[model samples]
Target: MGRIEGKVAIVTGAASGIGAGVASRFLAEGASVLAVDRAPAPAPGTDGARFDSLQVDLAQPDAAARIANRCIERFGAIDILANNAGICDYRLLEDTDDATWDRAIAINLTAMFKLCRATAAVMKARGWGRIINTASIMAERPYPSLTAYTASKHAVAGLTKSVAIELGAHGITANYILPGAVLTGITAPLIAADPTLRETYDTMGVVNRMAMPEDIANAFLFLASDEASFITGHGLAVDGGALLKM
Candidate 1:
């Protein structure tokens, strides 16, 4: 049997990038997956035996509730919750406007808070759960021009830790994954616009190549499995040793 056979998972930002990758992996492992994203529909790697999709903006206050309800309604249970939706603003502090900052925090941090709250309730009642949030290598280190993005991701680490501490007694584990120089939907356009950036990322890590979404997805799969039951409130780095130089 698959590691998570007969289980159910809720994966946000599932239209593309790491979210889609995670959803696809979970489904392949025999889990019923609800792939959530702001896109009208998610069409990606999730061709596994059991999969579903939900379209909603994570920034919406009611979105968390809607996603939670819809997943339970369709899949019957919430075994894994992956809060992977995020937005990054490429601006220095001086160029960062209030709206840009607010949107960054709303999508990256606040929305995740609501999602954890909504999903953890059901997980608690079920007596077991795994909650994984996508943070960035920037959560601890930093780059030159992404103040808002860095701050929000930094907050993700702390928020996830707090959630883990509080939910551990209830058999729910909360952790965050820190990715570095990943080639995803968000970064693809940027790299295409500036091809030089691609080389920068490719060589940024000691492994000498930028990471693919699937590379990050594998980490989520490990954490979601029963093998990781005792692990919680930690930042799992899937960064290919990028932090070593940072």
Candidate 2:
């Protein structure tokens, strides 16, 4: 049997990239998924199993509640939540503006907070849940021009730990994953512009190659599984020892 068999998971920003990868992985592990994203759903010819798709921009004030409701409607209970929706831009602290900073907070951190608040109530009532937030290695060892992303991800780590402590008594687990230099379509264009740039970025992590989406997804699968019942209030690094390079 698959590790997460019969579970129901909610994955945010799941139309593409890491979020999509995690959703696909969850399904392969025999979990039903409620996929939330602002992007359009995959088309009819898409080559994988389907999920119940909810289109909502997470930056919107009520998006979290809407997703929580959709999850309940589709699957009766939310066994896991993968808070994987986020965005980043390369701008130095001096170059970043208030609007950009606010946008980053709203999307990367606040929305996840809201989701946890909304979903936790349900999970608490049910007495079981897994919450996995997507943090970044840059949250601790930051780079130039990444102030907003770094700060938001730092908040994510704190939030994960805090929630884990608060919800543990209810049989809810909250954990964060720190991923370094994952290669996605978002970075594909940059690599196309200059292939060696990918290699340069790869070397920033202890591992010499960029992490694939499946690599991160595999970790999510583990965190949501019964085997991880004892793991909570922790920030697990799936960064190929990127912290060591720092």
Candidate 3:
């Protein structure tokens, strides 16, 4: 039987990259998925993967409530939640304007906080849930031109931990995953613009190859499954040893 055969999951940022991989994997493992994204529904793309879709810009104040509500309306329960929607703002501290900082925090950290707040309530009522958020290698290690992104990611670690603690008594678990340099929808264009960047990222980690979306998705699958029932308030690093190099 599939690990999460009868579970229902809500996966954000489901249009592309790591989000797409997670959605596809979860479906394969027998879970019904409600995929969320602002760009589009299942674009970039899980062409044949069957799943429900919601288009909502996470930056909106009421987006979180809407997402949680939609998942319930569509699937009846939210057994797993993957707060994977985020943006990577590449700007140095000096070049980062107020708008840039605020936007990054809104998408990367604040939105997660709200969604967790909304979903956890439902999970508590049901007495079972799994919350897996996407932090970054930058969550623990900062880098040049990624000041805003780094700060927001760092906050994700603490935000998730607090949720984990608050929900443990409710048969709920919360954790975040730290992804390293991965070839994704967001990074593909960046690498395309500069072919040299391909090699640079491929070699950033000890593995000597860039991580694929599936690599991160694998971590998500584990944390969401019953296998990780005891793993709460933890930060799982799916980075290919990239943190060591950083």
Clashes of each: 0, 0, 0
Residue 226 lDDT in model 3? 90
Model 1, 1-246: lDDT tens digits are: 888888899999898889988888888888889899988445545454477788898888899999999988887889899999999878988999999999999999999999899888789999999999999999989898899999999999999999999999999899999999898988899999999999999888899999999999999999999999999999998988999989
Model 2, TM vs. native = 0.95
Worst ten in a row by lDDT for model 2 = 41-50
Question: Relative to the unseen true structure, what is the C-alpha lDDT of residue 35 in candidate 1, on a scale of 0 to 100?
Answer: 90
Q: How close is every model to the real structure, measured as TM-score?
A: 0.96, 0.95, 0.96
Candidate 2 local lDDT, 69-131, one digit each (tens)? 988987888889999999998899999999999999999999999999999989888888999
RMSD to the hidden true structure, all candidates: 1.4, 2.0, 2.0
Candidate with more favorable, higher lDDT: 2 or 3: 3
Candidate 2 stretches with Cα past 4 Å from truth are 43-50
Looking at model 3, which ten-residue stretch has the lowest summed lDDT?
41-50
- CA error at residue 167 for candidate 1, angstroms: 0.7
Clashes of 2: 0
The predicted structure with the larger lDDT, 1 or 2, is 1
Q: After superposition, how far is residue 128 of candidate 1 from its true place, in Å?
A: 0.4
lDDT ranking, high to low: 1, 3, 2
> Judged by TM-score, which candidate is best?
1
